[model samples]
Target chain A: MSELEIAGCSKYYKKNGEPMCALAETDLHVKNGRFVSIIGPSGCGKSTLFNIIAGLIRPSGGHVLLDGKDITQESGHVGYMLQKDLLLPWRSILDNVIIGLEIRGVSKKQARERALPMLKNYGLGGFEYDHPDALSGGMRQRAGLIRTLLYDKDVILLDEPFGALDAQTRMQMQNWLLDIWKDFKKTVLFVTHDIDEAIYLSDEIHVFTHRPGRIKATIEVDLPRPRSEKTLMNDRFLTLKKELLLMLREEQVSSN
Target chain B: MSDQLKDNEPFIEDPSVRTTKLRRRAFVGQVLVGVIILFLWEFLTRLGWLDSYYWSSPSTIVRTGWKAITQGTLLQDLAYTSGSTILGFVSGTAAGYILGLSFWWSELYSRIFEPYMIAFNAIPKLALAPVLVIMFGIGFDSKVVLAFLMTIIVAAIAACSGVQSVDRDLEKMLVSLGAKRRHVFMKVVVPTTIPWIVSILKINISLALAGTIVGEFISSRQGIGRMILYAGQVLNIDLVWVGVVALSLLSIVMYLGTVWLEHVLMKGRAPKS
Candidate 1:
């Protein structure tokens, strides 16, 4: 059974008196332990899809199943990372990471115990007592990631997690994410407009159309595992990049 | 990021030394300004250019202050005023926070009571002191009630706005983490509202003190306000100036103490600027 299943998912917003569909008749299935990337132009409802899967928003139509259980209405089971770091400035790095555990009724001692290993593993050791205001953008984002991971959820939703970073920092974070994913082995649904990132990090890329977003095509990346920036030079990588660009460009042309 | 504080930077190079320097500079400036003003005032009064009856010289006021302190009258009156201020502040803040949270949690309560609360606050609280004295009598009860009446409105308004100002994104974050309504309030809402509440408390301190003094002015046997009233009636200009100076000092000290406590409570969430 698939880890996540969505059937006939549709969302609409009313502007004035008309119905504006965000996701129309969208259907997709994510297998367990898969790194899936949803790529599209701006305003393509990719974030809407993330919000739906993360149970942050209720779908106007259809249902979602997680691990063979209906979890369309259930919240707190799936972890979501937003574009902004959203780290509470009043909390220390360690306290921020342990927020999820604290919400789940874990004692301070127990939560710290669980969080300490993650902090050390993530190279945030010794800075745990420092406030979020004291940290750099990259460090803050890392803390946000660990915060979601502390929830112990099987699936993680990332919405343009690196979109706010500069080019160099984005590249660095992409590799960092790949390294963390290798160790943690959690299913990741990453949303991004950067086609190179989607191709570099995801096992399968789902190309979405504009406005009323729909899956134009699903292209599997048969590239070798443990990918790096050097892998972008491979012929297959270039070919996949060309195909995704074409699909995105064609969708833009059609929409215009 | 951790290394941001390690360098020999100007303001942050030696945090302790820099903070002490800043404090000392401020103290020096204040003293210089005070001395210059007193010199000018003394010159004017000696030349008979200013009314000495209404505005006594700084030295005369200081002598009166020393006398009051020596006789323990100043301390007694200060204690009485401080007692009423503290009692009213605590009770008013508590009632305001509870009501504000309830308004946030329940729309029914907000709709039913918000208008009445606004109207109550709109009425000048000083005008109600006489009525309060009549109802609660010319004792501590009237003074405490008057102070509470003056302070609680500001607290409730600030807290309600603070609750409404909670970041919606953070609210969603909490909700997705399986935080129930109460947990959301206790953990997210309350903590987020604390800075706002503390700011309101700072403002309410002055209002509460004003209310206490007003109550004493209308009807009271003892208190700093009563002493000032008696001094003014008898044309004891120096004693009146002493009372004014003492009240100003007390207010300044209380305000600074509240701010210091705020810093301690919000150590982690230091403002960037």
Candidate 2:
């Protein structure tokens, strides 16, 4: 039931009194429970496309349809996360996790009751009452992800959620994310410039082209799920990585 | 580090313990410096090396202070000055804070009023003491009004910066979670700005005191300012020194109280030691 569609989306920004193209006409569709990744070179407007879908910004030239409804320039239909955890330093980890619930009128007591178990089930068990500064970077990022998930949105848009982590932690987070995605059955649209990350996590990887980004290629990874570290060394995985790498390199050169 | 620890093992004092010791030593040194200055003044005056008529000695100052405390209107003057300062600071900061927070509700409103606020802030509030005393009259109200004038603009400016420094990305995060405009303000803007508002409390306290003193000097019959002014006119050097000492002690107490309040307001948010 959680399907998303972007129809003829385009974005424009005013730079020095001139209308500059940020995202060209674009169309994207994600069926229920599918995992999609958007990857491209720097300044290729991957984030612009991401924001348009998240409804944080308007597309200027098209509409964003979520669950078959026009949601262009609107927010709150989906959960969003960025590379930085953005946790309020004052609030406890448990409280931070339930911010969205509180915003939607959930009583504090009820929110705490619901979040306690989730916090325990995740690795943040006894650390619930501690402030964000007490947690490691990976733990903080995990808390951020939990916050996004607990928001209970049908679609989640993550813009480089693990981009700030070290290579080892990023690998662990990728596997952890897959488990959560499979268990929750929620549609996810992830954006990253890391080709390996794109191929490892997404069911379909949307490769974006140079500045004024448009979908350059859509590569479908048919590898079996319950994906693990072993999947990273698979022949198909390497092939997809090589292919995405080539496309992104072409875009990066043109952009520079 | 205990005496029981063997001296042969080079003792490493705990960091917190070392910090406490250093702070204690600094306080002792500060008090020692004050004692030396007072002792020298008293000794010099008794030896006739310093003129007692022009430069009152510590002993004379203390005697005058004690006499004023026990018989004169010292307590009443203390209450009046401190009352106006606290009243002015609280009211001015609250009013300006609310006014500044309202700006977040409308961009047009903030932009339209920004220049006016800046212009108002530029005026020396102390210079308006005579006008305020005339407007509010030579009573507690005049002193309170002056103190209010001194603090209001500064509080408003602090709050405006707090509003501007709000994390837009955090606002976006809240919006993505189905939060509305007021929700973003309460959940995001207010908590984020609390630190900013609290930071100005220390500054506003001193400003409020200055305004109160200035207003009292301009017209009021009470307050430490009036007491000092009367003593200067009458050539009561000891009383003037007593008034100066009392004011210093008063301001120190007020400043420490503000630090405590700031600590309380930031209870959960204060950075870990």
| Candidate achieving the largest lDDT | 2
* Clash pairs detected, candidate 2: none
Model 2 residue A253 lDDT? 77
lDDT tens per residue, model 1, B39-75: 9998888777888877788878888899998974998
Task: For candidate 2, give the docking quality class from DockQ.
Answer: medium
Question: What lDDT is reached at residue A239 by model 1?
Answer: 98
Residue B123's lDDT within candidate 2 is 93
Backbone clashes for every candidate come to 0, 0
Give me the displacement of residue B163 in model 1, in angstroms: 1.8
Stretch of 10 with least lDDT, candidate 2 chain A: A247-256
Candidate 2 local lDDT, B25-77, one digit each (tens): 99999999989998999999999899888888988888899999999999899
i-RMSD values for every candidate model:
1.8, 2.0
lDDT of each: 0.86, 0.89
How closely does chain A match the true chain A in each prediction, as TM-score? Answer: 0.97, 0.97
Error of 2 at A97 (Å): 1.3
RMSD of 1: 4.2
